[model samples]
Target: MDVRVLGRGPAEPFLGAQDLFETEYDLSMPVRVRIRRDPDERTWTGHYPDHHVLNISAQAATSAMARELALHEYAHMRRNEEAHPSHTQSTAEALYLALAGRRVERRKLTHCYQIANHMKDIYADDITLSVAPADKLVAFLEASLATALADRPHDPPRWQRLTPAADPDITAVNAAFALALCERHDLLTPDHRLYDLAHAAADDAPGVSIERFKHRFKTLVDDPDESEYRKALVDVTHQYAVETGQAAD
Candidate 1:
């Protein structure tokens, strides 16, 4: 698949700072940027495996805000690259902090965030952790991948630091979190549609894009007893796939 940026309008002149970042930033790949007066997504950037930004769009954000959001997204790409001595920003996390990113910051360390940080630790200890156990206490860092994938199909305005796109495989981790959260509390109605959708997405014949698949999967968590609706939706999704040429290939 290819990511093509839709440049529907006149390209906005590159502001001085963005121009500078475009020329001087440590981007691993070239990113196409387009500013819009009104975008369905407040601020979003898509990237292909080519490491290029397929599209970066924002609807009239101040230069400072755009700069910060760009830096924030950049951190997601350069996340694993350790900083050299010449580089001041060591980890992507550090770079985010340096840029004053993150919508929420705990004055003290948080148990939820810490637990997510220690997911590897729990595995290392060889202790069997219950799936429903850590519903609300997973670390932000650990759950980061899930949150990223979740936002791709529905990139809302506010999910910063937690809304970068991720690979489809990461959805399982989030699915686990959803189930665990529901088990701990009955927030989900029994007729939820997502349970079946998740199974369908995991099935050999996933009939939609990963983001769409996940959106459908989340439908269950929102309604637990909607089995008939879920069935009809599945059939509709399959029929739509056939009509749209997805099923042919």
Candidate 2:
């Protein structure tokens, strides 16, 4: 893996940890990881699949967050190349509701995206937690969860012209789910706030167990039976919405 640093200061520690990351994650593939300062401060970190590059905001990277962010992005890369599924299923579920003559709130569809991505983050965080120090991981989870809870959107637009695929809440929900999983795995001390945030973010699309969601998400991306997968996904999500009282009659 080739690690490159564009701007100085905040990204230096992330660059320095490149070797440690490779060793810990057993990353053997040739990928270029780039760390740059985000002038806009719009996001904590991001992964660009086309360029195989990871971009970290200057504020996030400088604040002792680079290690975990790197690990998170590394997990995303591995999943993208290996086991990860497309995020389109969430959008599809929303479309299913629309086609069925149900008025789907944009927020509900966005929650669906959140649920799917959060599940993936749980897996990603698992990989990161495996190699990171226990104390550091615990601290990271604590801080990240607090940030997620504080940043939760209280008044999201009731409707939007954009598809659920464009929703930005995935990032917030990802952090919440990561923390919830950390609490579940005893990586962090039990905290009701973490649980609350996780469930609240997922409240719109309820009744589906996390395990079931994980299975469905994986099948949606990994199953060779494309037609069956699509049908099953739509059926399952529609049933879930109806049962949860999220679907219009």
Candidate 1: stretches off by over 4 Å: 1-25, 34-38, 54-58, 61-64, 80-249
**Cα error, candidate 2, residue 89 (Å):** 7.1
* Local distance difference test scores for all models: 0.35, 0.53
| TM, every model | 0.25, 0.61
Evaluated against the true structure, the overall lDDT of model 2 is 0.53
Residue 151 in candidate 2, Cα distance off native in Å: 7.0
Q: Which window of ten consecutive residues has the lowest lDDT sum in model 1?
A: 123-132
Candidate 1 structure, TM-score to reference:
0.25
With a 3 Å backbone cut-off (N, CA, C), the pairs that clash in candidate 2 are: none
**Candidate 1 per-residue lDDT over residues 45-109, each given as its tens digit:** 45455544523444534433343444334433332232212112222332233223222223111
* Candidate with the greatest lDDT versus the true structure: 2
What's the C-alpha lDDT at position 94 in model 1?
29
lDDT of 2 by residue, 1-249 (tens): 666556554555655556556666654454454445565553333445444566666666676666667766676666555534432234555446443777656666656655645545655666666666656666665566556545544555334534333222343335444555665456644564555555654553344444344344434333334355446546545644554455576
